[model samples]
Target: MVGGGFAGLWAVRALKSAPVRITLVDRGNHHLFQPLLYQVATAGLSAPDIAAPLRQILRRQKNVVVRMATVSTIDADAKTLELDCDGGNETLAFDYLLLATGATHAYFGNERWAAHAPGLKTLDDALDLRRKLLLAFERAESETDPDARDAWLSFGIIGGGPTGVELAGTLAEIARHTLQGEFRNIDPSRARVRLIEAGPRVLASFPEDLSEKARKQLERLGVEVSTGTPVKDITADGYRLGETFVPAKTIVWAAGVSASPLGECLGVPLDKAGRVPVEPDLTVPGHPDIFVAGDLATLKQANGKPVPGVAPAAKQMGKHVAKAIRARLKGVGIAPFRYRDFGNLATIGRMAAVVDLGAWKFSGIVAWWFWLLAHLFFLIGFRNRSVVLLNWSVAYWTHQRAARIILGGDDTRC
Candidate 1:
C-alpha cells in the first residue's frame, strides 16, 4: 500500500481483516483531516489539533507496517517499488500493490505563481497561510500609504468550489467580525475578500438553486463573488482577471488539481486530469495485481459522470480494492466495485449550509449543524473531536478567532 491520505487510511483499515502483509508508505507520518484544513488556514485550529500520527493510529494492527519514505518510481515490470529513504535508496517487492497516491494543486499551466500564492493541501500549507494572513493584518495596522494598506487587507481566493467558498467566507468572518476591534489604526472590518470563478456559478457541481443560494449567502457575508471571470495572470502585486486588476497581497489557489505522476511512471492510460483509468474492480488495466484509488484513479459512474474526488468516494474505492484483494487470495470470484452515493455537504460560514442526500435536500442553520456534526464525527481521534467542538463553541459564542498568532515571516511587502 502506498499513500496515506483518507483513501490510504481506509484501505489499511479494510485490509486489517485480510491475510495480506500490508506495508503503508508515505512521505509524512501524520494523517491530516483535510476538509477542515481551511479552518486551520483561517487560524481557527492548530496543526496538532487536526492531524494524527500514522504509527500511533495503527500501532495495534500488527499486520500493517508504516514506513516514512518518498516513493521514487514504480517498476511494474519487475513488480518492485523504489523508494528514497533519508540516507539511502531501498526497494520492496510485492505480490500485489495498491496505488493510492493522491493529487496536487494544479496551477493551470502557470506554475510560477505557486510560491506567491500557495494552495492549502497540507498542514504546512495551512500554517503558511495562517502566517501570511496574520502578517497582512499586522502590516496593514502600521501601513501609512492608503494604497499599500488596501492591498495588504485585500484577499483573493481563486475558484468557487467548496474549498474556495469556505475559505472566502471564513476569512470574511475573521476580518469583519473577529478582528473588528483588535487594531486601532486599521479597521479590519473593512477587509475585502474576493472570490473569483471562471464558471457561470459557484459550486458548479451542485444544483442551480443551491448554487444561487450559496451566492446570496456569500454576498450577505460581505464577500465579493465574481463569476464568469477567469484570472489571466497572478503576480506579487495582484491578479489580472480580463480587463480588471485586483490588488490583493494574499492570493490563494483552490482552483485546479492534477493526479500524482505514479500512473505516468507505470506507463498506464490516464484521463484528462492525469488520473489513471482503472478497471471496474479498481485495478489497473493489464495489471490486475496492481490497484489504484482516490483522486489518482478515474472511475466513471453508470450515468457517465466521473466519480467525485471527495474523501468518501476515495474511501469507498479503497475498501473495494481491499475486498477484491482478499477475494483473489481466497480463490473466490471477485465482485465489481460499486459506489454508494451518500450525498454532499458544503457550509457557508456559520449560519448557512447545503446538503443533498439524493432524495433529501437541506439548507440553512439546521444543515450547518448537521455538517458540523458529520465532520466532527468523521475526524480521527477523540482529542481532535473534543478540541474542534470546543473551538467551534467558543467561536460561536464569542465571535472571536483564537489561533491568529503568526509563527514566522515578514508580511510588510505582502
Candidate 2:
C-alpha cells in the first residue's frame, strides 16, 4: 500500500481476511473525505468534519500496519520502495505493490500562478482559501474607495467542473445569505462570484439538460456563470479570462488536475495527464504483482470512455484489485476489471442539485436530498457525519456559517 486515500483504504478493507500482511505507507496520518473539501473552503464546514485519523480508522485490522513516510523513489525491478523518513531514506522490499497515490492541482505550465490562485485539493488548501475568502470581505469592509471595494468583493473561480461549481455556489450563498446583516460597512450580498469555464458547458460530463439546470441553479444563487472563457493570467490583483480583465481579490483554480508525480517512479507508459496506463486487471503491464488504481491509473471503459477520476471509481478499482490478488493467490484465472457507474451527483445550492442515474435523470430539491443523504452515508466516520449534518442544518436554518474564523497566514491582505 502506497497511499492512505479512498483507493488505498478500500483495498486494505477488502483484504482484511486475507493471509497477506499489509504495510500501508503514506506521508499523512489521516484519511481525508475529499468531496466535502469545498465546504471547508467556503466556511460551510470545518476541517475536522471531513477528516479522520488513519490509525483510528484501522485500529482493529490486525493484519495492517500503517507507516508515516513519503515515498522518494521506486526501483521497479528490485521491487523496493525508497521512503524518505526522519530526514533519511528507508527502503522496503515488497512482493506485491499497490500504488493508490492520488492527484494534485494542475496549473497547465503556469505553476507560478498557484501563488496567487490557490487550488483546493488538501486540508491546507481549504484553510488557505477560507482565509483568503473571509479576509476579502474583511478588507472590503474597511475599504472606502468604491472600485477597490468592488475588487475586494469579487471572487474569480477558474473552472465549471463539479468542484468549481460547488465552490462558486457555496460562495454565492455565503455572500448573499450566510453573512447577511453581519457586516456594518460592506454588504456581503454585493460580493461577485464568477464561475469561468473554458468548456462549452458546465459539468460537461452530465447530460445537456442537467448541465443547463445546474447552471440555472447557480445563477439563482447570484453566481455569474461564464462558459468558453479560459483563464490566461493570474496576479495579485485578479485574473484575466482570456482577453477580458477581471479584478478580483481572490482567485481559485479548480480546473485541471494531474496524477501524482509518484507515477513517474513506476517506469510505465503514462497518459497525457501523467496517469499510469494499467492493464485490464488494474496491474502494471507484464507485472501482475504490482497494481495501480485511483486517479493515478488511467483506464478506459468498455465504451472507450475514460473512467472518471471520482471517489466511487477509485473505490471500485481498489475493490477489484483486491479481488484480483485473491484470485491469483487461489490459482484461479483473473477477470478483467469492469467499473460500475452508479451515478453522478453535484449539489448546486441549498435544496438544489442535479443527478444523473443512467436511465433516470433528475434535478432540483429531490436531487438535492439525494446528494445530501449520499454524502452523509459515504462519510468515513459517524462522528464526521454527525458534525457535518449538524453544521449543515444550522447553516440551512439560520443562514449563518459558523466556521468563518481565519486561522493563519503571514500577510492577511486579501
Please give the TM-score that candidate 1 achieves against the real structure. 0.98
Best by lDDT: 2
Give the Å error, residue 45, model 2. 1.3
Candidate 1: stretches off by over 4 Å: 410-414
TM-score of each: 0.98, 0.98
Error of 1 at 2 (Å): 0.5
